[model samples]
Target chain A: MPGVKKCLQEAMAIPGAIGASIVDYTTGFPVAMTGAAPNEDHEAAAAGTADVVQAAQSRSLFVSAVPHDLLEDLIITTAGGYHLLRLVPTDFDSRLVLYVWLDRLRGNLAVARRRMQTLAEQLVV
Target chain B: MTPAKSPGPGSLLTRVAGERRTGALVVGGTPGGTVYLAEGQVTYAESAAAPGVGELLTASGRLAARTWQAALDAGSAQASVGRLLLDQGHLTQGELELCVLGATYDAAYFALAAGTAAFHEGVRHWLGDVVSIDAAALNRESGRRIRLLNEIIANPRIDTAAVIPVPRPPRERVTLTAAQWELLVHADGQRTPADLAQLLGRAGFATIQELRRLAALGLIEQPKARATDNPDFVRLPRMRGASAPAHRHAAPESPAAGVSIDLSIDVPLDGDPTRAAVPAAVATSAPPVSTSGDPPAERPRLDRRKPGAKLPKEIAAEPPQPHPGTDEVLLKRIRTALRALR
Candidate 1:
């Protein structure tokens, strides 16, 4: 199993990836992060991503009404970029999600979604 | 010029860091905690006010209580419990490191209040060292958190009080953040912020901060000190000095004396999870069974001690029973839900 740093590195390698973070949504803190420039407010963005995940999990409309309802992933598309969040499955009571920011011009949303799922499953932290 | 030379939480930590010492610093006094150092870096810390890592791991459903107990039993003497857990595949190396780091920071926050810390040479926690946190960095972060908490929460003491939900939310239509909603669901007027943190499997500081936010928004009632009403207080006099005047006067004041006595007994018993779990048959037999069916002999024995000294009849006869509280049951359900997520 890859550690958090390795997971972040792999995430950064994804096509058109601008930034990646393993965010603990419960506390709105990043477990590990990569790819953001030195001046970028990655922590603030990670905190915002946490809110997005929380909103999906808590709101009735966003929550899946199936018998075993759990959020799978979240995606946000803006004019310039795509934000992808995939929950990490863990035996521990951790509310962690892998978030990747992709440039709209270079990234394929479909490919990013599929790639994130694999990373989420394989990521060890 | 160097300021008052006192061996406090910060000074001791600074001293250890300067010396690059390896051992345990037992910080004692009110709100005391222990910080374990490995070559001047903090590897583990524990506070009486904060839940330990074992509790955090167990309560979070990441590891079962039995699993933790087994690790302690097996690896405590050797100081390789963390290694054992990692070797067993219970948690990955990264997960263990993160868990230890999170718990150390959480404990250090509450433990670093102004107080003298004593150093114990060569002592170490069983988990050994997965990662070393710089003492200076930890102090700064803890200070930052305190400042953040103070800014959000007007009253710092509210963190220790029992949090209760507003009986009627001020707004007819309200929107709650995920943390606020969870805090509301478990508010229950009984749990403090610290308890809520454990219940929710979140960091202690995070829970308190969320609670402060909730309070600021008036989404939840400000936490209040628990009521002074003590059921045990009444039981004290009744158990000792059977002819106590206060009891005689109190009994006459109540119209339904016999029924009230039973109801009062029920109230305290029901509130106590331990006593409530005892079967009726076993409970009824408990008082008599303690003295071998001789209350007279027990009375003399009890009288030898100070007044109100006899152990409550229920306590003396408290039987072993499965006493899972509501939160434990909820945590189990949460674990099941988490399993489904996996």
Candidate 2:
């Protein structure tokens, strides 16, 4: 079974990866994380991301087509870095999310997405 | 300003500072908790872990949006928040307490997960002290119970984001508390138990308890965890309509049978109008004989007796014959007899 440390290490290896975290979106709790950012609470980031996902899903426009499923992935590009949120499929109750912070200058968006997707498929809960 | 203790790295305040922002960080426990303020204002709070304050008030369907908006707009400063909510009559003390308990737990579970740095902020306000209770302990206990319930139900997937799939009804229609029924009915494949608590305006612990109980009773489907490569390995079950039982326990024989038993005991001669009429005749006949001495007193006694027996017969006979004139005559006779006696 691949553990959280392995996941974080692999996530960090991606070019320009600054930080990575495994988050339990439901409770906005960070199961595990790796990064170096002053005063940043990864747990809060996980929770805030969950909140963002919830806000997005609440729109009626998404309701008709999405089958009420959890968010599969979310990407937000900031001036300094890229924020990636990926929702991993699990039991209906244990909805887990991955939050990745990538430096914008060096990170390849397409490559990062592909790598995260592949990694997600192999993660053993 | 003895630099109110600088929140350590990863504390709630540090995170807020890192983001360079400010807003009330409401934390919830199980039954009750406290609120913390920053900069001479309310910043953090704790309540029960179930339906949060915002959700409870909205779900209750009693307070209006305008009232909530007004209270929030007034600011979350400890003193102001309470006074404003009270002034608007959005909630009574008891109701507010319940809401706070629920909200505190909800917020605390989420907030604690975010980090404990939240408590290290330079400025802090303890609403627990304000309310005259150990809000922290209450919230902590509630939070722990909710987490335990989540684990016991083994539905780790049903967190804040994942919606709860509806469960199949039981074959032997089981009895459920009103809250459990409501929870089941409201499971819209989108709201987690926590979310439902907020939507339903219930405490988080209560919601989890009901869910755990239901799952234990085999009334709901439990999700199985699947291995995946994703760093986030949790798997939320994809919800689909649950299968109905092949044979439903027949609806409980109407409670009317029990009601009938009560009725029979309450009214022994319900069916016999003639038997009921006999009492009226006896009473009237006796009243006439006694009228010579004190007609007024005798008349009232007769009047009271008449209703006990005569009213039933009258109701059975013509069904609606006793009208305004008869009632007037009866009153007049009683009055006249009283005057005669005086």
Candidate 3:
């Protein structure tokens, strides 16, 4: 099992990555974060993203036809970067989302999403 | 060796971490909380004042209680309950950590608050250590939380007492966030913020924060010291007989009193308005015969004005004659008494 730090390191290594964090969506705390500048407010980002994830999950209640699994990853594209969040399913609680902010010019959304899923699969804690 | 007397929570934790002691720091003894430390690091903390990780998990709708119990049964022999839950996909590692983090801090707040505590060596929690936090760091965080709470809420003790909701009049509506609404719906007069949190399956701290916010907004009230809290409560009732005539003669041209009379006159002089205004005016205008100051004696009278309480025909119809001081008092008492009667 890859530890949180190791997982974050690998996530940060993704092409065009600006920052990455394993966030606990339930409490909005980042378990680990890397590749962000000193001034970057990763905690605020984690909390804001957790709210987005919660809002998305709440939508599952109204939209009965689509299963929750279909929305495995939530992607938000900004002018300068791409923000990708993938849910990490676990045995106990699945309220975890791996968040990675990528430079739009250097990152490929398709590639980052696939890599994050693989990395999240190996996360132990 | 006898332990030092009256050591602060931080020093006690620092000493424990220095020795790298493993076991529980039991605070407040019987039905007290335990802060589980592993080699001087905090592995877990629990308090009777706060809910545990299991409660939080189930309350959050993340795990069923029975499933958790079954996992406990299965993992009991190996001391790997966390692992069992993990293996069964109850929650992700990050989620577990978050729960642990929140629960630890929640419990620690109460544990450290107890101040006087004892260390029990070699004790272990069945769930095992999901993650470890430095005791010193935990202490600092707890302190920071206390300070933050003080900043947000004037009286932190609202966490302990039952929060009676003071419903506003239909015209004077208050807006609430979803979380605040949930809290309000669950806030029966009997439940303290802590009790409400337990019932709602939310973080106790968050619930307390909401209570404080509500208190600041005059939405929720602590039952303690209710009578004297309002300056008007003390002054208004006495303004009756003596002060009434004296004020009427002295300030005949008073716009404030004139506005109040106008407001009362506009009350259609019908049904309950005439009756309501006289007694209310009398009740409020009557001079205080004695200042004995027993709250219980005043409680029933004050209770009538509570938000949810049925407003007497006159008081409801005529709105108290506009003595700003008396009006302010009337408004406050009404809100204070508006408990969710159930």
Candidate 4:
């Protein structure tokens, strides 16, 4: 959907956003992305992110008292930046996960979270 | 023997066309490669130079040895293994096609590289395919010079003769498709990619593709041949349960006893007494009967009630039919006759 592109662009436009991608959770495929990589290997990145998401999901299932479906978002802050994975379920078992790489220095965790929620709600998958 | 100069596109095509063989031909260079297979041709392809098709399939969790063997037998008898698996509903058409393409490409890539080292026409090796590929298309897609094949052969990584095991990354994770998971579960580490494909009822190409993908992900490493052993040989990990001997024995025994005594024997009897009764009656009635000599009793008839059959019968026996327009019909007939005569 054009909305996905708009959402990704909007996410990227955020002050500290380094890169953003819309990933399909089921197949671990990238539906859309906005970023620059040296190798330009978006497929590999999407696949890698998908794997990370799966691991996180499995971990949540094992450790948490809450049911698996309650898992909404995962945030990993690295020395370079913050990696946010937001799972958005749609009409079918098909799910959309918005992956945002935010520069730690400029990124406001609160604002990014709010913005991601708004964007995820507005996203028409 | 040193690999000869990489064949020109024209020469590769001519060779393929002249041979009129059906199977994928892979051309590798700096970037990547391509594969092409004829309708009925078979190819031998391996990934990581260590694990062959069987190992790849089993490692991927795709198929069990017994199940894979059954499919292989069926495939051999059927028209094409790829097509047969699809028809048997073991794999989807898309999966089959992908498997075929992937296996062919992987095999061709290794085979061409190996072929360059020591050229032999008739002697069949188990690692790569015998089919030819469209060399021009491969070079064009990969965007590499054809001459690079000769140089690539010199690198021991690509050479079958060296048999260096590709190093596997520790704690690396991979997201596998359902079929890939099945292959890995069944791998038990012994079967090669080709063997796994046959057992899993998957095409060779698909198994190889998964192996390559897994290798790229660094989950599995290729095996290296030792100085004491044959240089060209590659070894895969031992089967899944090989290391845990006690667990292997204990695991199967518990499951076997529990399942056999608890579920297998009791479940059907407890759940469907009728099913057990029917079989028992059949067995008791024919003690010394030859299973092949006599046809089995006819399968229990299904309740064959046609969709609207009951409705029609109900409607038919309801009551006397109504003659709504008898008087009107008689009046209309009189009027029509009068009009016609006039």
Error of 3 at B151 (Å): 3.1
Q: Where is model 4 chain B poorest over a 10-residue stretch in terms of lDDT?
A: B239-248
DockQ of each: 0.24, 0.02, 0.14, 0.04
TM-score-wise, the better of 2 and 3 is 3
Output candidate 2 Cα RMSD. 25.5
Instruction: Evaluate candidate 3 and give its CAPRI docking class based on DockQ.
Output: incorrect
Each candidate: how many clashes?
Answer: 1, 62, 21, 40
Give candidate 3's TM-score.
Answer: 0.60
lDDT of 2 by residue, B111-189 (tens): 4443224333443332222232233342344355456565666554333323343345556567665567887777754
For each prediction in turn, the share of the native Cα contacts (below 8 Å between chains A and B) that it retains comes to 0.34, 0.00, 0.06, 0.00
Interface RMSD (Å), every candidate = 3.3, 17.5, 5.7, 13.0
Model 2 segments beyond 4 Å from truth? A1-125, B1-50, B76-79, B88-90, B113-170, B226-342
- Candidate with the greatest lDDT versus the true structure: 1
Deviation from native of the Cα of residue B154 in model 1, angstroms:
2.5
Residue A25 Cα positional deviation in candidate 3, in Å, after optimal superposition? 8.4
Off by over 4 Å in 3: A1-10, A22-31, A34-37, A40-105, A108-125, B1-5, B29-32, B74-78, B88-92, B169-171, B222-342
Error of 1 at A12 (Å): 3.4
Put down candidate 1 lDDT per residue, A9-92, tens digits, no spaces.
888888989999877675566656788822497667766887888778877897765765678898889898888999987654
In model 2, the Cα lDDT at residue B281 comes to: 40
Model 4 spans with C-alpha error above 4 angstroms: A1-125, B5-36, B39-55, B77-79, B114-135, B139-231, B234-342
Q: Write the per-residue lDDT of candidate 3 for residues B1-342, one digit (tens) a residue.
A: 213476755567778888999988876532246788888889888765566677677756678878976886787566678888888887666567756776777778767764467778988776788888877767765775676568766675576655567646233767664568898887654455655665566666667766777777778753332212221112222211211222222323444544444333323322343354565444443334353365543322222123344444433343434344334323432432241010
Give the worst 10-residue stretch by lDDT in candidate 3 chain B.
B231-240
Residue-level lDDT tens digits of model 1 in B1-342: 112346778778878878999998876554567888988988998764565667678877778888987887687778888989888888776677667777777778877765567788787787878768788877876776687778886766466655666667777898776667888887655566765666667667777777888888777655222233332101211111111211222333233443343343344333554544343323333444346556552232122223335543434554433223434644653553343233
